[model samples]
Target: MSDREKLEARLVWERPEPASRPAPEPLSREQIVRAAIALADADGLAAVSLRKVGASLDAGPMRLYGYLSSKEELLELMVDAVYGEMASEGPLTGDWRRALSAMAQRTRRAAKRHAWFIDLLGGRPHLGPHVLAHVEATFAALSGAPGFEHIDSVMLAVGTVDAYVLGALRNEASKLERGMNQAEWEAVSGPYIQRMISTGRFPMLAQVVRDATHPSADVVFERGLDCVLDGIAARLGR
Candidate 1:
């Protein structure tokens, strides 16, 4: 089986039955949200249409309108739900660097697990309760870090990590498509690497890849975090 096949076998976004459970009481908004979450958790986010969510809930798409105003609203809710899973209260124990690193790692892991999430997340950034909760947790994690005086600095720090994680995933997803594992990325890109070298057309670009250690998602993310932290520490005189 191909890697995609294995991924399909493993991550289920849609429930097996794809129908909502019968409830003893009238379906509350909470029930609707829960059903949507289950549907997304079982199936990839791409499959979580309003109709699909309602079908999973054993209701028609129109029924979902009674609660959520539109499909966009529902998607936002789902994003928020995913955010709810992030670590809420563990960021500020003692070591600030450790805390920041922990938060970055956890976010990276979360992105990898919910692989389709980052695709839709940025498209809608109004931020539901759950998304806010996760951001709050992230801020809390960086609370005592240097240069967090204004909310802008904090937002910038969080955005930097978020961008780093998302960028890393883009590379990973591309590799997954091309069957280019770590070793393969280096081997396959070798020609592309060499072409620039011999051309001498772009010396700087050529040299970078010539000695260039082909970067991995982890390495890129860690380097980005280190740079950001270094800048923050510098500004704060830490």
Candidate 2:
């Protein structure tokens, strides 16, 4: 069968009901997905496997196949589970800017909590219910805005937000993966950077590095988000 067909068959929301039988096993797809997420949370994505997840649940590795056919499926479900958290925040209010900004911040927070999540950001297609719900929320936020009446415009706006958030969080995740805080990163790299600046080869960059006051990550994120929203507003002529 095609991969799409296999995925459709295995979707947690689309699984068929089993024939009448004895009581259900203590294990479930939800349980398996949660176990995998916890593994990823504690030890990063590479540490997550059906074997490890099963051990955590006191079940055998083979037991996971009945719920998720492969590790790929497990990753997909884990991503959707995160999307579920984003969706549970409820629908957007009429103010698209505020709604989009709030969504971006929430996504940033989720990425921070689950650093492994950054690796999976836009890694594959997510047709899971929660992922679709999040998409719907994005559309709903921009639905009636002027100059965004076209579906393409709505999608572009949403995509722009997604792109910005992913790019920002990618940088954050890299720092985390390196186990270095901002100050430490600077301290370690500062000498080389200062030497490069003093060479006069990158005068503009050197000026900015020397003269500009670097903001905290949170402040930088908010400011970047505001700039993106301002661009969107200009496009919408709002």
Candidate 3:
């Protein structure tokens, strides 16, 4: 397929109805996507495939082709499905800072639930319905902020929150993936780090490492988020 055709195919919503339809079966696109998500959650994104998902559903791999044409399409479907999980209960209440903070928290929770999600984020264009709803809600939150009267300003504010959340999640997810409990890591690396610091070549690094208190993951995330929000508030003079 040409690039345009591929892009069209990737968009599940834009696809035209099949000229002829097969008789309805017990399976559905939702089921297929859910099965794929389960596989990804249990293993990792790399473990998700047509064959594995089919096995999970007790159907042949060919059965999924009716719903998703390729692995890329499957991934897009999976991404949208997770975004669906992030749907907020109500609309933004015009408190831009609170709305942005809530949205960041929701995204972080979703990433924690679906660790594989962090890998797929920004991997491709997400024009899916759920993703668009998220974008719309964010814009609505920043719509009338003092310095964000322009759409560009609104988008910049939203992007700033996104960047901060994604960066924080990367560090959080890495710790989980390594299976290294904080105490265990400290025990293993503490002696080695102290020995290196004793060499006197890195006094500044040693001093900082010794003096700085290690905060819990939740504390670190909240502190970083507050700092970002403060910057945005300052920019908007709010």
Candidate 4:
């Protein structure tokens, strides 16, 4: 057989190219949303531009507009996507404290998974389905807790844990960006403390600094949750 005939016979239909596909007919909204989410995850929210997202999907920025109304809508969608990462169930046992603790730990783990999610504003509630699911789950966890009488107290409790977790994660991101190990950071900041000690301009500040430590946020987090639970238990009369 001729070379052309032999080549035609040997062609593999199932081995079609991924990158060479004709951009998948019409672009999907889910496609655009996934591309946008990944862009923010890889680079950061600041780096997520419509053009960049479209380029990733082998399309143009105008195509993305057909999926999302605006950049703000895209960001809101991405925020909900992160909330979808959370598990909706609490601890197996019916103990309120244990359930809440499990939730706080899981939520903190989610922050580590999606660092971009820390940018979500806690004061303003987003009504996205995934975010609403998260709220429903959290309230369910503390359902029988004594002091969680109303949504206000429940919100305050959840807000405290979320605020602590978000702030801690942001600080962690900052330390990572500074490109120094914890020991190196402490060593560099140590000299400023020494200078203050010797100058005595602020004796009280120096004393406090001398005793201060950069404890892992986990430690502070547990302490803060303990406080919240303590208050709740007090109200429960347990």
Candidate 5:
């Protein structure tokens, strides 16, 4: 099979049910996915494996193959499940800025809820139904914007906003995964940084350390999102 066909094959939604019989009872695709997500939520993604998931389900690992062919397929389902969570939180607004901003913030919140989400992101396209719906909703919102008459403009707008969200969320998730909060980070590295600034060789760094107002993560995220949205508005002549 071609690459796209292989991907499609892995999508349980796309496959038709066998006319003769249903999947065996007491074990299901949904159960497997739910178990895997729970395992991932408690432990990191590394803790999730077919064996562990099967164990959680009180089934042998081989039984899981009836639903999921491989770990990669399970991951696709897990990521798509998170997208479903994002959609459930709220609907996108008619205004482009409102829609995009909401999406970025909502996605960040999702990452916070599912810390392993960042690890599954990137390196491949998410072709699941929920993700495709998100892409469609985003395109619809952007298309209604003033300067987004052309498809290319809409695509660019989506890409720009998505890039910012992914970068910011990844940064935040990485820190959390390291078991360090902002205060903890500062406590560990602050002494070395202050010592460096004391030499007077890094005046700008010292000035920032001395004068910059350290805001909460949420505030900083909002400020950065506003900057991105402002640039997009300027480009779109809104």
Candidate 6:
């Protein structure tokens, strides 16, 4: 299909099931998506394909097209599946700040559980039912808050929070994917960094490297989240 045609194609969720009787083997969209997700989880998004997913289900790749029009549809289904996983963490509570903080934390935890999740994030707008529900819940968190009186304000606030959360998750996932955990990074580059700092050419860098008490990832994430919320509150005059 042409690009425009592909873009206008109906989503898997919107498409009607095959008009014919069910396949003798009883394959379903959920089964296809679940198998695709398993492949992604075990390896990465690159490892998931219509052929592989079909093989996992003991069917041919053509069988999957009966349910999903294209691989893009499968990806959309997979992304929505992960959103369903995120929603299972339960609803947000407390005031706007607390609600948003909880949302970010929950999202971070979800990304940690599914590293491939970060790969799909930010690529396209997901409008699946579960995705819409999560968006609705997020909007509900700021619905009647003081600074979110306008829809624009609510959109801005949510977008800002999403930006921070996605960036943080992507960074962490990238590090893990490269097999360079914090300890590995330090072990590999520590000597070179220390030598550069000892040259006294960059005082601020030297001071930060020498004096900063690097907190645990959890602590750092919480502090950064709080800082983002603080900025939002102050900027919005809440």
- The candidate maximizing TM-score is 6
**Model 5 C-alpha lDDT per residue in residues 142-187, reported as the tens digit of each score:** 7856788898988887788888888888877777866878889999
Off by over 4 Å in 2: 1-7, 10-12, 17-25
| Candidate that beats the other on lDDT, 2 or 4, i.e. the better one | 2
lDDT values of the candidates? 0.65, 0.83, 0.84, 0.70, 0.85, 0.86
Could you tell me the lDDT of residue 133 within candidate 1? 67
TM-score of each: 0.68, 0.90, 0.90, 0.75, 0.90, 0.91
Could you give candidate 3's per-residue lDDT for residues 1-238 as a string of tens digits?
8999987776677774334434444777788899999999999998999999989888888867867788888888888888888885566564888989888888888998999998888655687788899889889888877788899989898999998998899888888877788788879989999899999999987988889887889899999999998999898775
Collision pairs in model 3: none
The local lDDT score (0 to 100) that residue 52 gets in candidate 5 is 99
* Residue 238 shift from truth in candidate 4, angstroms: 9.8
Best by lDDT: 6
Model 6, 1-238: lDDT tens digits are 9987776666667777776545557888888899999998899889999999999888899878889988888988998988898899889889999889988988888787777887888966998888999999999989879988898888898899899989888777776776778889889989998899889898998888889998877887888888898999899874
Model 1 CA lDDT for position 8: 64
Off by more than 4 A, model 4:
1-26, 88-93, 177-179, 208-213, 235-238
Ten residues in sequence with the least summed lDDT for candidate 2: 16-25
Considering lDDT, where higher is better, how would the candidates rank from best to worst?
6, 5, 3, 2, 4, 1
Residue runs of model 5 more than 4 Å from their true location after superposition:
1-13, 16-25
